[model samples]
Structure formats: structure tokens, C-alpha cells
Target: MRKADLLDELRAEIGAMSDKYSSELEKLYQFVCNSLFDNMADYQWVSIYLVEDFSFCLKFERGQTELPPVIPFGEGFMSLAAARGSVVRERIWNRTEVYVPFYHGHHLVGVLVVTGTAGGNIDDEDISLFCELASLFESKVKKCNS
Candidate 1:
């Protein structure tokens, strides 16, 4: 499916999910991650890191490999995105990665980390879509808390 159509479908699914299952934020995170990986070929994995005290904890992930459970607020791409309040992109271990920070009413809530498939580079379009998805997740988080 095209990117726009995919995003529309995602939004619809998320809305239905919210109506049907008023679960925790982590469940929503996992659903988004899994959906992105399953629908977007460029992405191999996705994870959500939430700010916890002095560190950003890995709250949910869906991928082939596991990420560290905890990372300092200033460390790594995801942490840096949260700290800087902007998107961060980098290439490491032969894969392109993007980290988009999630904010809820000016409060930095978490970061969404997306990694490209092996041997492939993440393009700007993919990054933009991931960022949009992060924003959707952020809105969902805000609604749940409100």
C-alpha cells in the first residue's frame, strides 16, 4: 500500500483500538511498532523508550533484536532525541536509524526509535512517516492521561 493510505489505515486502527480496548500506553506502543514493521518494508524494528527519572527506559519494542533496558537521559539516539526535543538520525552497524521524540503538552514523554532493515538506509520519507506515527502515539498518550 502507498504511504498515505497506510497512514490513514493506521489512524483508523488506532482509533478503533482506543474505543475497543482502553489498555495501557505500552500496549498502544507495541501495536504501533508492530504495525509499522509489518507494513513498512524499510523498517526492520521499532521501539519506544520512556523517560523514567534519570534514564530513558525501554518500555516496548518489536524487532529481531533486543535493546538495552535502560539508558541514561543523554545517551544514544533515542535519549538524545528526548533530551534535545528533536528528531535524530544516524547510521550505525550498517543500518540507518531515526529517533523521534514524543511530547505530551510540553512534557517529554518518550522517544520512538526506528531502525532500517539490514543493508538498507532509511530515507527521509520513512523518517517523516515515523515521526508522524510518533505524533499520533503522543496524542494517544495525552488522551489516555487526560
Candidate 2:
């Protein structure tokens, strides 16, 4: 599909979602993974990592058996997103990495990482959608923490 079309579709999907419950956030994460898998068709793994105590912890994951242990906010792609406060994309020999930062007001919350086969690439649209989703997740987390 065209990049614009993919982005529009993602925006529509995200707009339809309601982040009123934690379960809804889980569903959103699953939806993102499924959408990425369907659209790109080369992802081996997709996961959501949230900030906790200045670290990024795996919250949900798909297509992977084991994930790295809790990661600090200054390490890995997740940390890169948090540190840069922006989306980071890179292509590896066997995998593609994408990280989108989550923000709560001015505070950095966490990041969402999507990894796919080398043939698949993460585009600007994917990064935007991931950041939007992360913002929703951050909002929900803030409400719960309050």
C-alpha cells in the first residue's frame, strides 16, 4: 500500500480506539502489532515497552519467545527514543528497528519498538502512529497512577 494510505488507515484505527481502560491499551498494542504484521509482512517481533523507574520494561510482545530483560532509559533503541524524544529507525541485516517515544505532557514516559525482517522497513507513518498510541498509553498510565 502507499505510505499515505497506510498512515491514513492507521490514524483511523487509532481514532476509533478509546483508551478508557488498561485492557483497551492492551488491545491497541495488539492491534498495532497485527497491523504492522499485515502491512509490512516481514516482522518477526513487535513489542511495547513502558517506562518504569527510569527503565523500559516489556509490557506486551508478539512473535518472540524471550525478550531482553528490563532496559535502562539510556540503552538500546528504546532509550534512544526516550533520550532523543523522537522516533528512531534503523535497518539491521536481519531485522529493522523502530522506536517511538511516549510523552505525558512534558515528561517522557516510554517507547514502543517494532522489529521486522530486513525486507520490511519502518516508515514515517509507522513512527507517527506508534507515537500516537504511546501517547494514549501514557495518558492511561497517568490516570491509573494518580
| Residue-wise C-alpha lDDT for candidate 1, range 55-118, written one tens digit per residue | 8888778776446889887677776777677889988888888889988888888888888887
Instruction: Write one digit per residue (lDDT tens) for candidate 2, span 50-105.
Output: 77897888877767624485987677777777778888887767567887887777
**Model 1 lDDT-worst window of ten:** 14-23
- Once superposed on the true structure, which residue ranges of model 2 sit more than 4 Å away at CA? 1-3, 19-23, 65-67, 138-146
Poorest 10 consecutive residues of model 2 by lDDT? Answer: 15-24
Clashing pairs in 1: none
Using alpha carbons, what is the TM-score of model 1? Answer: 0.82
- Quote the lDDT for 137 in model 1: 72
| Decoy 2 TM-score against native | 0.74
